[model samples]
Target: MEEAPKTLAHQIGGIQNDALRFGLHGVKSDLVGSHPLDVAHRSTIKTHEDMKRKVLANTYGSAFPLKMDLDRQILTRFQRPPGPIPSSMLGLEALNGSLDDFGFEDYLNDPRESEVYRPQDMHHGMEVRLGISKGPVCPSFV
Candidate 1:
């Protein structure tokens, strides 16, 4: 490829930092005209230098530790549901201090009002019952 004649333009910003551009050219800076604007540029140059140092520190200085982290494996245990509380632990429980003993002598709370049907109370299974529908039982058609 043939290269064209290059023209230098005064950059408004201090320095251009691009990987591709830095790769192609060494480093680009446009503090041209050797009049030495030292007083005006001293702060700007210091700021740029500080930024460059910070970037270099972050990029090169702060690298992954050379020591292999092979021992950095974290071992996590599998949690399981706890077993049933023992008889001794029952009394120690905060919610229910002690369990009540349940018993049924007659089994029925009141035999007089019991709903169980006896032989004398039987209706001879004469109650009319509806058959199951084969089609949809939607109420919209009805």
Candidate 2:
């Protein structure tokens, strides 16, 4: 039995001139235009010079950073909510007096009445007797 070739050779055929396959023209152009020999270096130098000018202007001229008095400015620009009218101010006192007339103080002081008003028994009975279809049980019942 004969042994097969160990190295693989890719064949690029159909070109009339084999010399055209070497890419000599592209390689020559790349060498000539490589970084140190091209317009890229000149452009970088010009950009650095422009940056230096901007830095000098900001440091020595009227282009300094801004300082603002935020509290004074915001206070001057802000609008306050309208003040309460005299009738509304008097209404608060009348409401407080009415609570006193309603015996709210006596109710608050009674120990028997101190228990939270809960209707849990009513809620459980509704759930057992009426089922879920009847709307939400009153929050007072919960």
Candidate 3:
């Protein structure tokens, strides 16, 4: 019947409008959730340890012992070489100039050149090669 087709058209139009309304509402909900206030609220529940664990886990997986050992090796590699006070550190002017030439500024500026520069891909590949199973372990590793 003509009336039945008209009714179906109206119903379809109403459903389409409802879907558009729902989509717009979803965008609005996402906007509110991403607001600074909501972000701060979410961050407040996370502690320093949680952040550190996330960083370490992301960079080194769950291998804490290996990660710690690698960190120690990197640190030990950067220790200052043993030597006597050079002529550069003798006077105030010389001391200032020597301090300027100590390379700390360069080190701070270009961290990528640091001894501990571990690429994410390399770390993940190394972890896989080490036979560390991904995700939750079974009763065997336990």
Candidate 4:
């Protein structure tokens, strides 16, 4: 469980680094996937067509066309951080890398009952609900 956040941080850092690299090399946003302007134009045309069909009830009848916003989708899928990448660390400080005395065991059984939601409650709750004290040592269920 502790490794999950660290692994995610590593992956996110790699992606951020790649974006920085692409930005530094002058990768144009318009060139990514399809051109946004072109996609918007096509979407406008499709919307007009759908509107015409709905009004006339020629083929689809009164059913409205369920069309996705292609332009917005493309922009969202390829959005880069605006301006230059910051020299300072982004938001990695929230992870364990920044904490000096952060310990995982504290979450399981902490002295501050009001401050922390102990995992023992969840463990005992599940045991009570399932009518079992502790889980089996091996893969006995399978």
Q: lDDT of each model, Cα atoms only?
A: 0.32, 0.41, 0.41, 0.39
- Model 1 quality (TM-score): 0.18
- After superposition on all CA atoms, what RMSD does each candidate show versus the true structure? 37.9, 37.4, 25.9, 25.8
Question: lDDT tens string, model 1, 21-112?
Answer: 22222322343443467766787977875776577567767442221122122111222222222123432232222235343523546333
Tell me the tens digit of each residue's lDDT in model 3 across 79-99.
322222112223433422344
CA lDDT for candidate 4? 0.39
How much lDDT does candidate 3 score?
A: 0.41
**Number of residue pairs clashing in candidate 3, backbone atoms closer than 3 angstroms, sequence gap of 3 or more or interchain:** 0
Write the residue-wise lDDT of candidate 4 on 9-105 in tens digits: 2221223223322223334643667778999999998798677657656565443333323333443444222222212232233221344546664
TM-score of predicted model 4?
A: 0.22
Best by lDDT: 3
Model 4 spans with C-alpha error above 4 angstroms: 1-9, 12-16, 19-24, 27-40, 52-60, 63-142
All candidates in order of TM-score, best leading: 4, 2, 3, 1
Off by over 4 Å in 2: 1-37, 62-142
Ordering by lDDT: 3, 2, 4, 1
